[model samples]
Target: MILLFGLFFILLIIGTSIANSMFISSIIYMIYYGLPLEMIPQRMAAGVDSFTLLAVIFFVLAGALMNRGGITTRIFTLAEKCVGHYTGGLAHANVLASIIFAGMSGSAIADTGGLGAIELKAMKDGGYDEDFSLAITGASSLIGPVIPPSVPLVLFGVTASQSVGDLFNAGIIPGILLGIIMMVVNYFICRKRNYGVSPKASLKEVLKCFIWAFWAIFLVVIIRGGIAFGVFTPTEAAVIAVAYAIILGLIYKAVKIKELPSVIKETLGTSVSVLYILSAATLFSWILTYEQIPQTIAGYLIGLTDNALLLLLIIMLILLFVGLFMDITPAIVILTPILLPAVSAVGIDLIWFGVIMILCLLVGLITPPVGMVLFVLSGISDVPIAKISRAIAPYLVASIGVILLIIFYVYLMTLNPSLPKLY
Candidate 1:
């Protein structure tokens, strides 16, 4: 196991693709142990053969659907309506808009692209700096995976055999907390720069936008509320969300028949990337299991530390650093299996730990080296990565503050404790 892990890192350092890195590392272990190659296909298939994992494709498509269905614009309108009166009104609206968005789609990249494209442009048009627009939009996108129906959380739940509904419920409070902190930080900064909404919309106009878009808003409630009351599983909720978005899109005349092909193509491409990594990672984990590597490491770690909190924190730090180098979805798929048993050994709550892990890694995806969100903002704003990363400083501080709250404050971290727990 140590030899395999060492080789994986070496492959990574040399710029190998993570999928191929894991694949080669597993092959080294199999060869070392004189195992048959047949286990590879079998284990890989087992990993990919998950019903819960199918949620990844569904939610990814559902998020893209809502965006095309004119729901993105409606969400922006609603956020703008409610927060456009603040000192840093547009910035505040960006934060709030992301919170609303995180509910509809549990993907960080999707939210970043969907909401950031719209809000960053609006911010620039409203007298905000391009870099500043880039920064806030990127940071706001982090909330998506921490909120309900988060794709990473769903993946974690499925991979770890934790409760998906409980995981969804557990995410709500922390998600809102993440939103609030960003809004507060944005408010103070925007006030300092004196960048509020330019020519704020009339209440009538904002209300009109909201009224015209009311059904789009309802999808969040219907999906979340239905899931909470046990009316549908998360997978079923995904189907409902797609149907809802399509029906509403048609009713609003926002989605035309012509858009279907492009939408399907995009969704299929995205889903394939995710599913490919999943299948490959599963094969890798099967190798680990066959070798009893995870169990052996779990035992070794337990022997070293009994403090669940310390162990969990250390794991988070590792995730934070790893996230700096990789994208979130692949990281979650690859690492969750390896880490779950070890954390469980220390008695850390799986669901809570999962949220913490996702948050840390998601932030990493926005950090330097390979910060995916940073790159997204760079592409959108045409700001250099170095410059956009500078803009990330304050929000990064605020994110760390949120991370600390989740780590130390038990009641607040868990949020009402009565919210069905996920671990």
Candidate 2:
């Protein structure tokens, strides 16, 4: 047990990739235990064999197709028309655009890499502060994986063997709350900073943009409605999302059939990287389970407190700490098993817990050191990481507030039978 984690951390500190570090450490653990080396490949194969994981690939492809297909611009334009008139209106639009795009793409990286560029450019042209613009863009992208059709939620469902549909249903309110809180935070910050606001669009113009962006907006309804109504499985919804994206691209004349190969190539690269991390992390998690590490940890946590709310707070802290260093996929894959027993032991709802866990993990994307969203936005805006990190602090606080709010809501519901259920 000591060797497994010790080697893994050392490798991480020495700049090894998370996937490679887990893969190497697991192999070494197997060798040291005199376990069959053949088990490595078998475990990895088993990890990737999940049918639920297929949703990750299709969602990645759907996001890429929409990005390449120019669907994002229409969404952004509509967001601007609706919200660009208030103080810090462009900033509000930045958050709104992310909320809408979150329905289409389940990945934060995709949201950052796709809608982010358009948003940053628009804000810059609208004469918004660059730091504020970049910060909101990075922070808002976190919403992508919290909303329906979320890749992280899919990964969580598969890892914890929870229902993806239930997770999706549980996430809807919190995800919207995340955006609303960010916008509220933006309003105060912009007011204090005296940020510029755009002129209000005429009602006719707003309707025109909505009409133009109707197909783009409808993607959200299709995904959330399909899942909510049981019209399709999450995996099947992903396929429909891709097909819809392609058809919309053709209709908008924004993407050509010939352009699809490039989009697909990009999708393949992302999907392979995610699957590799999941596979390696699964094997690593399996070895930990073989050593009974998760059980030991869970027992220790349970010994500390039986109070469900307090236990959840401790779990959230641990998840936030892990998210600081690890990417979302492997973090979910590795920690879900280790932490889930403790979560279940406390009688917390798995679906709600899954949503909370993923949201906590998603915070890592905008944080320092390994924040993928930070890097994505920095590359897009040419802003320094330190600047982006500093700028994102207030919004970060807003995000944690949302998490706490949800936790308290669940806690209150636990105390009151009259309260509605999460799902």
lDDT of 1 by residue, 60-145 (tens): 88888877777888888778777777788888888888888888889888888888788977777788878888888899999998
- Estimate TM-scores for all models: 0.92, 0.98
TM-score of 2: 0.98
Q: Each candidate: how many clashes? A: 1, 0
Query: What is the per-residue lDDT of model 2 for residues 1-423, given as tens digits with 9 covering 90 to 100?
Result: 889999999999999999999999999989998988988999899999998899999999999989988789999999999999998899999889988999999888889899888998888898778898889999999999998889999999999999999998888889899999999999999999887888899999999999999988899999889988989999999999999999999998999999999888988988899889988998999998988989999999999998889988988899889889999899999999999898888777788889989989999998998999999888877889999999999998999899998887776766675788767
Off by over 4 Å in 1: 198-206, 410-423
Candidate 1 yields a Cα-based lDDT of 0.81
Q: Please report how far candidate 1 places residue 189 from its true position, in Å.
A: 1.3
User: Which pairs clash inside model 1?
Assistant: 351-423
Per-residue error (Å), model 1, residue 137: 0.2
Which 10 consecutive positions of candidate 2 have the poorest summed lDDT? 408-417
Query: In model 2, what is the error at residue 140, expressed in angstroms?
Result: 0.5
